[model samples]
Target: ISYVFIVENTGNVTLTNIQVQDVLPGLMLTGGPIAQLLPGEIDSTTFTATYIITQEDLDTGSVTNSASVSSEAPRGDLNDPSDDIVDTSDDPNDSSNEDPNGDGDPDDPTVTLVNSIYDLEVSKEVDELEPVVGDEVTFTIEVANIGNVTATDIVISEQIPSGYVYVNHIATNGNISYSDITGEWTITQLDPDQVEILQVTVEVLGFGDYLNIAYVQSSVGGNDVNIGNDEDSAEVDPICLTIYNEFSPDGDGVNETFVIDCLERFPDNKLEVYNRWGNMVYSTRGYLNDWSGTTNGRAVVKDSDNLPAGTYYYVLDLGDGSDPRVGWLYINRKN
Candidate 1:
């Protein structure tokens, strides 16, 4: 980086032996000392200095330096060397400590901020993409520091959509807390190339589509450059087991078979049908919803015979450690 300093003789008296000096080290100055500067005369000759930026400056995020100009007032006492006073004043352009009145106090300090990269990427995933009602789904949220500098005081915000209740959360390198449908994760710092993972578990309360979103809410030490990858979301669709009460298998093409909604979601399941006499007439493991009023159990019922139209009882075991669902099923053969 290069810096230019312009000194003007704003005083009434003529200034002599004008010299400019910068506080930063290793900055080469290539301007000569002005022999004399008249009153109200802006110096035509400019003082220029060049300095190379270092990695340390980028790490700190900014560089601040100031230049000072000093000259001999003479005070009409050129013959008397002791009476000639030297006046030094800092640059007036520095806002931190400007010296507009040419005061001898130390003041000027120009700040230059280094454009440090601050990028954070967030991604989310769920263990069960399609979950069943009352099932607990685990969501994984990962945050990575893809910038060149370390991010400090990072806070991540998480939102759990409706139809789900917060169970618990675990973070690898942060403090995770939640209230109702919102969650927060706090971290002291995350260095470049470092990553953190947080796992949040929620139980599906009702049957519906639920979307969970996570993003980097705030962070200090640097500004985030890329906002596109700062947030991520995962969706889970829960299915509820539904059983149809009646079906007509008369080859009318409507309600032709006993329909069980979401029954295929449970691979390990059993279905049993019983007549009014407490005799099991049909039973099968992994029922495929193909039972069309045919007798599949006892030899007395005749395997190929279609039972008369009547109301029967059914017991379905989902094999998921839950109690079996019992309900009444009606079969109609009337045209």
Candidate 2:
């Protein structure tokens, strides 16, 4: 930064050997040392100086420099011969001195304020920790600015794992758009101590451990102060189930009952079967993979011992306080 000092002869006598001195380290004073200045006469030559700002200065928030002017006074006692030196130092207690900014100190010390820092933290969360297949899961992503300055043009990215399809998204303070596996959130500005939340919904196609990740991609500022909290991830494990859609209840002694893989894992489950007319045909608790073409004797068809071949619906509840699983089931007695 460049600095200019304009020294004026405010005293009554003529001053000689006028010079300027700055207390800031590494500051080099250039230009001329005026020879003499009459009363009420400002220096005609320019006395300038320059100093390079460092990272330490920026971190300190402000840089303060104090300057003073010294000169040689005219000889008054020619007979008693005395060396006279006059100096005008920056005195904060001097009320008569000029203080343009009026910070209560009349020294006129230069203070340059440095810009503040930028810090953005991201966190991710999932509504369902263990969801079933074909379930819609919602992920909440939050971005907070913990710095002192306002952040602008922030871009956050979301990475949707495989076996999951993007459904839709909603944001509190930004615009979001996504493809199949990748999504982007663009924010115009976020003030200090402000937070923005974005919720994305996706459908689980298959069963596995799905890990969704979100992070701060970029911003208009230089860089985030703390990068440790720039990214976060949420994990979900869907419960997989293998159901036999079509079953044969013929007297062949094979495939005579409905089978469901991993059903024994949840012994506290309840299975309910419904016909095409939404009528409950069979309902049982603690199913042991046993169910033939016969109903509970309440919805008997043409034959009292067996039902005709047709399509049916079933609802399986794991009794774990989760949503019940619903699907189609087929009964083929002719096979």
Candidate 3:
């Protein structure tokens, strides 16, 4: 990567012996040794430096560089008395060349370093795409740092929406803390080019869409340079479908027929019961909440006389173009 530094002369009098120095880590100073600068002069000249990005840099995302400048003004150009060289005994000009502090340089110069650039991106997902109410939903939040400098004290947070409640045992691959008071999950830091995945489990309390939004930001005392990718959200809508895992057709008038709670809402539905070998044992169209555990083709009345007691498979189709409900059903009949 390449960068540039600017040097300007703001004083009233012309400055001499102007010099610029840049001390940057992981960067080699290729050129930019300015020797002089007149008053009101500005060096907008582009300075060239080379830097090879490392795996760590790519993983962490960025590096910082700081540069400094210095110059000498003629004795008459001195505006403030404090600008004059300090002396205790002899003349200031005579002692000017003398080095009491022994630092070797008599000029004190200061320069403001370049500001940092930032880039952050976030993505969120849920483990259960078709979750039901009261089910535990695990939300995964991914924050990626794509900037050019290391971001410090990074904080990522997620606020549990109104239809959810935060659960215990939140998992993450970064520095994190969970707060019940705020119903939030927080990650403390994320380096450039690095990605952090945070898994938080929450219970779905409502039946409608469960939308969760999360945001990522640098809290290292400065704003993120790119706040565009700082926030993301994911949602899951629970459907109205239920299945019964067991039923008895003993004719005792109690739990005698296989039941589906919401299948009646759709009048064009179909139900198919299969034996252990995937053979269609019972099939019905526009089912009226009836399954006597007997094969539809059987000529006997009792379930034991027609189909033996065992486990079976069922497919419920609501004819609504949605996914069909499939699960195991136990046929418990006593002769």
Candidate 4:
């Protein structure tokens, strides 16, 4: 393989440029632009040269590669003193150059991309902890990776709040975590285009509020790569865990349920649900709950009128009293 290399100075005052002919068999030369330079300044120039490379020349036995060339040249022409090479065989009187060092004709090198360029991405932000509270609200977290190489062993973790309690055990495929204790979560390995999910449950404690910093990191050895849980937090936030729930019939039906105005208890107090026997059945942080007049998933015994045509024993935790206020509820089903 044999080819000529060329360079052209197209920058201000003739910036540098190189003459390159890729000898890589699989590569196609893509043209580039020649920028403008100052007037009277040396214009960029490139040489047309030939080169070749063989598979046996590679140490790794890979044909993918790239080559570059740089040289100092004067203004113009082979005779220009600025040119590093003072020898010019283009002269008609030059007999030594006649046959062109020229006779055998074959020696070249090739250039190409290193190997492959890959882009990986994971959601940057997401609801880290979902299915919060007994059944109040859920969280969603997201992340993404975009780069030339594939990523592995990406893990996401979060700390449990002080007062709030852990609902479920952290589930992960393959990863190392701080501990197997409740509250902490992590994801092990995530290949290109692969995504891992973490689910956590929290019980809102007290009344004030709760926000904790969580992080997701890549298994990159060195330091941090983008959102790799480095700084105080490239991505950090305070989550206001206000427990809330509802039971307004989650389907296409107008009569299935009543628009239970729950979530209104945040300012009120813990709800104290009781059976006709005066036995407390359920309690909640917010009023966003709905009693189907049923024990668990089963229906509670009620008279046909549902009005109970009578009163049912119950207790209301009105925050005011350390003890619950007991009373009977009048069933008024709005048809």
Q: What is the TM-score of each candidate against the true structure?
A: 0.50, 0.46, 0.44, 0.32
In model 3, which range of ten residues has the least summed lDDT? 84-93
Identify the leading candidate in terms of TM-score. Answer: 1
Q: lDDT per residue, candidate 3, 1-335, as tens digits?
A: 66554666656777655445566567776555555667788776645566666645543444544455555547534445444322111122333454445655343222223434567788998888876655788888887777755555666667777767778645555376766566455666666577777777878754333778888633652456667678999987754455667878887898888876546557788888888777778888988777777787433334434577889888988888989888889989887
lDDT of 1 by residue, 1-335 (tens): 87777777777888887778776877788886878889888774567888876656765787787776767666555555455444344546665665555654546667777777889999999999877666899999999998877787888898777767889888785353444444677777788788988888999764334878889999876677889999999988776676887999999888988877667667788999999888888888988789999888776477879977999999999888899999999999985
| Local accuracy by lDDT, each model | 0.78, 0.77, 0.65, 0.39
lDDT tens readout by residue for model 4, 163-203? 35555534444463444264344445444345544445555
Residues 196-223, candidate 2, lDDT per residue (tens digit)?
Answer: 8888899975533388888888887657
Span of 10 residues, lowest total lDDT, candidate 2? 77-86
- Ranking of all predicted structures according to TM-score, beginning with the best and ending with the worst: 1, 2, 3, 4
- The number of the candidate with the highest lDDT is 1
The reply for model 3, stretches above 4 Å from the true place, is 1-115, 132-135, 205-209, 241-335
Pick out the ten consecutive residues of candidate 4 with the lowest summed lDDT: 85-94
Model 3, residue 232: what's the lDDT? 92
